[model samples]
Target: MLSTSHTVRRATSALLALSTSLLALALSAPASAEVIVRGTEGAPLHEARPAPGAIFPDEHIVVAQPSPSEVDPSFLGPVLLMKSAHIDLEKGTMTVPLRKGRLESGELVWSVLTDVTDENLANLHGINYSAKLAYGLIGKATRSARIEKDGTFVFASGKVDFKPEHAVTPGDAPNFFPPKSAQPGAIGDADYSPLVQFENGKNAVFNMPMVAFDASEETLNAMCDGAVDKTVVHDKVTAICPRDGTVTLQMTLGYTFGKPIFYLSTEANDPVVATLEGAILTPALNDTPFALEDAAPGESAERIYVFVNGPTGIDHPFRQGVNSALSDGGHGPLNVLGGIPTINLDYSPIWRLFPVLWTEEAIEKGWRTKLTNAIDIENAGAKGIVVSIAGGPPQAVGFLVNCPVVYRIN
Candidate 1:
């Protein structure tokens, strides 16, 4: 069973404002914590681990588990605990148990795992770690919800309309920067965010992905054998089995500091957000109201990395092939999602898109190389080596996404 409504979005802005604090708190994961490191600095990671599949022998990192005294178990992601949940790194799939909860108004909200308090929590939950989320503490970056004793999630704000027809049209080759046009499959309201903060006296936020809303358990259980209803669930969902209580999501291959990773692209604040991420365009996000074009500072927003001159060709080892020079008719450059496992200490589903273009002089003088981390990008920029579109500084294009890191490809 599936349900969606554009009207629900029209009335969500004001309602979302009432719960900003809770949502903000939900996305906040303190940065002062140790991280899990594997393998030597430039060597392959050890093969013995809990996660499934053998990835390329490279660096692999996850967050350390948080202390029990600092967080409530209820606030942590529960997918890893389910016997049925499994992650197949070779096939690039994460199948987790679904959670059945309801809204205060009795609307059903079927959610799944992937969100955690921090990397430690991520490690415990067997999900990906995103350092970017630790800084998503301000603005309307997340939604507020309270889990009642009766399994009801009393939401303060944020609703989605899965009814809108989703579409992504790639531009002609050589200029795929701005897609022809795009429409997010599921449109979220002003306060719609995947980061769920339980206001039930828990000081933690979980990056929970709500797979279905106002859906019946019996109908959802049909997915165990039947086809998944894309109209009812998130677009990234590939398979869902309510009977077994597991949902599988399709992962996009990407790079972070030269390491391969797999992530889920679900909701975005703008059409450009959807275009760059190959995600859905959500118009209602305009109401969330955050600083655009690089004004977001401190706990305001996280970064979405774009390579100015990465290796080109789909078969390239680095696989980022997003250089403007290679104007092939490719649909995506597969830009990097900043602040993953061993990278930085910030992660958020909501991201601000900024294009990094290498200066002609830098390219001419053979100063170009695979730039890793913001410092590398910034240093090159300072030396007049790189600039975004129009020979100017790369600016945030008023876009954001609710993408959660799921798996790493070593």
Candidate 2:
């Protein structure tokens, strides 16, 4: 939910002042007069004199009045009324009701400035003469799992500490294309755009964190050789010698947008060759083609391409292609240079997962395993071999790997 720590206090003070001013104006104003309220776009969104007992939704109305100096001299002493209350138009004032059901959406500006000159009346017609209000929603979720389960995992016994490296809240997805009748402000859809008619609600995107694990140096070395055994107990003895004789680890898949993605992190300087299934994954973009056939013996392969946040010298083929496509035939300012439209790409700091082949020995093993669908050799080598998974971001999911078991070597 949106934080209201300061909004509550601030709105309270403003409402009290507004009520007092409104009461004073009502006592001095004419008996009746037509009053209208306009939005920032100059559209007539509200009018005075709601039916008796009519209740307005809370948090939707904004009340404000222009200062006497701001108003034209010919329209001075005009009676500005909203609902059953009057407003002192002489002061630069604004308010939002703390209570519910007093005014409807866009009705806070439903005011009357009595005895207005015909010439000065045109000055009060535009949206600049009123207050603007906006409305929207936000949602979020989080979950985690270990490598030993197939579905969502419950944190039952172990003491686990989860740390997020990036901001989890999806930033505001502003509608750059607002209604033409409204100001070209950030929020809502364009007046004539078809997206406004769409029923599905909008969503904010967020970058979730990936789980980390630790491993022993011997186990890491064994993994580097392209062959290792999966251990049930996950102890030091199992790291050095696999009694299970299988190069697979039981992982708990957490909640994800699609399939689970994985990545391997070694010591900062000690780079390890990594491959997903049979394809080489590179962290940065270059002339290097991501093909398994091109990998040399003992060479590390990277299946996923990494792009740093903000503008950088790093070249990302995927991001570039998307940018090019938008520039070629996209709508709004995004079609022009330096104006990229809002697109939720599968890009974030969290590293994706893929079955990594650390050593050429592992590739040479030619294990026809269904886990990765990678079989250089006709015969399958290991039983119960499980391949790594990949998933997209802006999803609400958590990953809990045996950190000590996966990163102990590092």
lDDT at 161, model 1? 66
Q: Name the weakest run of 10 consecutive residues (lDDT summed) in model 2.
A: 332-341
Decoy 1 TM-score against native: 0.67
Local distance difference test scores for all models: 0.56, 0.19
Candidate 2, residues 87-206, lDDT tens digits: the string is 111111111111101011111100111111122221332101110000001111111112223422222111111121111121122211111221110111111000000112112211
The model with the greatest TM-score is: 1
Candidate with the greatest lDDT versus the true structure: 1
